[model samples]
Target chain A: MTALPDTTGKKLGLVIDLDTCVGCQACATSCKEWNTQGYSAPMTDRDPRGSDPDGPWLNRIHGYEIEPESGHDSRVVHFPRSCLHCETPACVTVCPTGASYKRAEDGIVLINPDTCIGCKLCSWACPYGAREYDVDHGVMKKCTLCVDRIYNENLEPEDRQPACVKACPTGARHFGDLGDPGSAVSQLVLERGGFDLLPEMGYKPTNKYLPPRTKRNTPQAGIEALPKGDGSAMDRLFKLADRLLSGAGN
Target chain B: MNPAYSVIFFTTASGAGYGLLALLGLTGARMGHAPSLLFAILTLIIALGLITAGLLSSTLHLGRPERAWRALSQWRTSWLSREGVAAIVTYPFALAFGLVWSGLVAIPDAVAPLGILTAILALTTVFTTGKIYATLTTIRAWNQPLTVPIYLFFALASGGALHWAISTILGMEPGTVPPVAGFALLMLAMLKLRYWGLIDNAPRDRTMANATGLGEHVRQWEVPHTSTNFVQREMGFVVARRHAQRLRKIFFLLLLLAGGLEGAATSVPAFAVPAALILLIAAWLERWLFFAEGEHVVTLFYGNPNA
Candidate 1:
């Protein structure tokens, strides 16, 4: 049913670390690779080789420049975005058909390919834009949290996890039962002070994002350590040249 | 928020249809003398035709139109499903009322009760339609108390205008329809102006920083994709403020013209049809603006400073 359950037996979700993500597309590509052929087959790249290739992808990584209010130096942060599988997901409840639903046992939201009419209401209901419209199949697709491989007895036990989590070279993506406070993922969240995205929206997202940590030795500190040059004409000229060159961006 | 033509057409057409049905049901039993068979047939045909055509047009944008029937199964939670169910239920009430009013069934006592029931169902269907957009919290512009009231007011105004034109065209006395329609048009104009003001001044707190859970001064350095994706195309649609201002002016001007013409029609019947047409055009512009101005929260991740 589209109506959400009162509670789930286990909140199986991912915890993404924004500090370690390198803006690499490994998680996104790996998610596409596994999901396209596994459950929700043929993720449908409308024009793969064309100048403007477009397709449905379950995960995407974005880059941002953060200039903190405090004296923390400005830095670039890479963020990986995906479905949070909220406890009270509007995407599931807004589905006119009973296609979009959250699993009562594990709390992972999934859309039934056979029943989705592709009205795109679920996509509209999502604040994170996690729902992807499959143009070829005329249905909605999204991150299933690797439900197929996560429980497959055929695969090696170590390989049983979400493709995105398994493929993260930096170990930025952690997956486990979030409902249990003693779980490793939950402990990581507690230690890092992991926070929910758009918390004011009040969906109570299951997944959490660990914010980037501040650098101990900032560029300003390093600049202060440099020796003060003797107040010579050539020194002033060199300083002017250095200032002009610094304004140019890569 | 992309303002798909199919949905715009569906809502406007069906909204007006339901409004007309409700009004007809309210006034049907009071008409002491039964109108000619031709008039009755024509009115019912126009109302039902607009409704059926609208319902069909709604499916045009669906990915799997064959599975559209499944939409009616989740009314327990979904406003869209409730709308479907209410719309289907209205059909039977409408048909029964149509038969009695047209003298085809000749059950005089059944007319009043059936008419009341039909009117209630028709209004409920329109209410459900309004809730579909109002309940969606992702789009800040649409998730408001005023949204549903605007929808209801537009329906009554447009439907009232249509009724005036039909009555005048069929040689029936226009009676209080002209004034009632004029009043509805004036009220709609006021409500719409207030709605615009509310949306413009509403606090937009959903920023890129909060949306991504990054620090307060976050700025998007790079998009996730080279080309625009479905989310951008669907929810990131933005309308220039200058163009929207011009359109708002055009909307009010059209509304004024419709109201003046509707008022004039009471004396000179020639103005009635033109008045209705002008009101419909105005309503369509309003509907288009409704979708175009909507700001979805997802757009914040795509570098929209605020939603």
Candidate 2:
């Protein structure tokens, strides 16, 4: 089996286009299904057969209704939160057992389950809450960025993608080498002004987010003077004339 | 910062055991208690053992056992590291104290050379335990200015209780146990009351809007993700305000019964021995809730209600 080019010596990451994301939750559902059975440790939901249920899951999406400007209609931006695979992951440095570490090769933060003690200290250290305790196995787990799948060469090159990226029906999630400026993900980021979450925390997140953009054409200046459809024909005509004048800054 | 029941008991119980011993070693020079030497030695060991066991149990949760030494190197930045260092340094001093104790010998005019070691070690142990809590900036409950003082008080209270209990068990008269036990209980009560007040007045840092970091007047209509993730499970733990109030009441009752037992006791030995143990458990419960009730600063980011 031909191995994909070494992601080593490069920082691999995701560029999530928030503008296009529909918040269908397809990515989250697909992730749970794939990682649960496919990955070594599935998210254990305690009390699944009853109420007061709690368990460990790797990726969680936080929904926010953001009204950035005052007196504006709110928009729900589906924030699919996961480990950003930071350049300097707080979780990595805080791990006492060296179980949690940022791969020197790819910059993807990963947990070496053998070394983890499940102290959950690494979880507390992380501001993103990316780490979860696998109660069944007694270890911390997180998004591997599909390190297992992305590099696997057994499947077609196009088929190799992170489960979340694969399952994103809206095509909001992109995976590639962020280091290369010419890469599709990188170019998209550069063009759209993708940003990192909680930038001030200074983890230097590898993942980037494309900001939400407004819809429709640029309205002419003073376009608000134009009257909406009304019953008074003469009044509407006069308002149109006024709008034309205001459009020219008269 | 769950403040696992075991750890809560371990730290407070162990701190008191060791802390009182350190005190006994320091004042052994002036006091005429026969077991001053014996108690001090036993306590130093007990404290060291408590700390060792706590450290060991904490490590049991780690994925990598062999790499434990790497943790100590990060003391400059990590509280866990600082805690480890302080504990290790204190252990040797504590051990040296027990070893060099000459108070056990017939020549008891002046105190042993180890008294100084003990005083330093006791202070160190108390600070280390407190630092462990104070370092957690995420848990608003623990990440307070009061964590250190509360820890110090517990150590004293537990030590007082342990001293009271041990002295009573050993048939030490009122000359030692009552005053220390009384002082310990009072100090412990004061700290608990102050902590209760601190939490009551603990101002909320974020509203729903500020937490989402979108605007000042924001409300979460829907969560972005379909499945639950780590942040929600870990940082988003919010205890109901009513439960917190109920907890406060229980804290008050326990404090009254446990911390106030010494003054109500008819006999120092008879009352102190049992009462101190009861209060230790109460102090422990208080510590656990202090952790569980603590709201992490990060919880605000997700629009979770502040506890």
Candidate 3:
């Protein structure tokens, strides 16, 4: 049972926009809140109010400063990471108990808590660090893509997406069937040049991240300016010229 | 790659146990011919005890130890399951070999075959254990061609050291086995040093930029959570360079001393127990370093991008 399905009809995954994400933790928090009481309830927080608080979380955000290159300017990118529901997820195949499995219908990777021994090998197998060991329930937890909400017929169609996608304030997160080439998410990825994280590792992650767009013709602004009438007219003109040259260079 | 003590002990102790078991399987027939009942019983007890204790210690790391039995069911894909099944299968052969050697049964020709079977099973179990880590592409430090050989050689070295100690105590002539043990010890030390060198020198194949797929030169500015989380605790363990260097020196020195003492003990005889004990301690330290030094690629997402 641990052997991954040869293929799935639909690969439900996420497409995140790095250019739009504001580095806010809304997606992560909403994911935590929904999953804490959903598929894997009580995602226990160890010493929540104490000095060294820690717990299991399916989604995590990381902020990175990409230094300036020869032509590109420096920028800050916030990366939200979770299980990509990989095509060849080692985490599923490495499970000794067959508790970790991928759905044949949708390609959604999940863990059956009732059978998991919580050996923590799946977490090690995952290159993205998507799986987390739930010390409280003694099971492995991961992103289900809000399986509970996605399939609940009672919920509104528009509200049935993943909690993180629904809660993204800047519309940075998107979810849909990636298996269909004509899907909205797939079209977005195609138009935006979406890429996989750690493509060289060869997990074949389903999720994609659209890179930040290059900054264009915006005038450089600086705090330091020429003092008004503080020197001779020639000196003031020279200072103004220097400032203009610096701004243009920037 | 947190070096959990329970796992370190499990691998170290189990490797040594399996190594000893394999050696005993190769030599049990000759010893049975000697009909040294005491030696047979004591060695089997020691070997089986180490194996049992190591296996039991491994369960301590499991979240539900009672469900450990379920782990053996998925051998078709899981190396851990294969290891479990192999270990379990070897027990009967080991028990038969022990019983025959101890003169509890008069199965004359069965001893050698059973011993060979046990040896094969032991090696298979050890190989599966090594594969468990070697197959993990996530941790670059562990995913390498050298990992399996390193595991195999260390197990042999430790087993050889223990075999020498037991043979010496049993009044056997210090034969070529001592020199073989010495050679294995040297190989283990060299392989471990080479592994360390390779990991240290290897380029950061999974950089933060590649991990995020954003751009090159991406450096972590902030972590997602304010508090430490499971990924940080499990895969974010970091060892300082100074301490790692010191431990490496100690491990090499201890292994060298063990090998030298064991080789010399063949003539002197008095240094055998000390040599085996030192080798055991060295193996433990080496296993500890093995876990502590492994930097999972996922750590790139946290702040230590240039591993």
Q: Give the winner by lDDT.
A: 1
Which should have the higher lDDT, number 1 or number 2? 1
Interface RMSD of 2: 6.8
Query: Lowest summed-lDDT stretch of 10 residues in model 2 chain A?
Result: A1-10
Q: Write the per-residue lDDT of candidate 3 for residues B49-154, one digit (tens) a residue.
A: 8888888988878988888998998899999989899889989989988887667898878888888888888878889999999999888889988898888887
Alpha-carbon local distance difference test for all models? 0.88, 0.67, 0.86
Docking class of 2: incorrect
- Candidate order by lDDT, decreasing, is 1, 3, 2
Ranking by DockQ: 1, 3, 2
- lDDT by residue for model 1 over B149-196, one digit each (tens)? 778777778878888788878888765556666777888889888888
lDDT of 2 at B167: 64
Which model, 2 or 3, shows the larger DockQ?
A: 3
Residue-wise C-alpha lDDT for candidate 3, range A1-250, written one tens digit per residue? 8998999999999999999999788998899999999887879888888888778888888888988776667889888889999999999999999999999999999998788999999999998989998888888899998999999898999999999999999999999999999999999999999999888888999999998887894556668774566688898898899999999999
lDDT of 2 by residue, B275-298 (tens): 777777777677767767877656
lDDT of 1 by residue, A31-68 (tens): 99999998889798987989899999999888899875
Model 2 per-residue lDDT tens digits across residues A1-250? 0111234477799998878888777877777677777554666777766645566656666666666464345577776777888776667765555556677677778877665666677777666677778777677888888887888898789878988999998899999888888899999999998887656556778888887786444344574564466658887888899899999995
Per-candidate TM equals 0.93, 0.73, 0.92
**Which scores better on lDDT, 2 or 3?**
3
Deviating ranges (above 4 Å) for candidate 1: A68-72, A220-250, B32-34
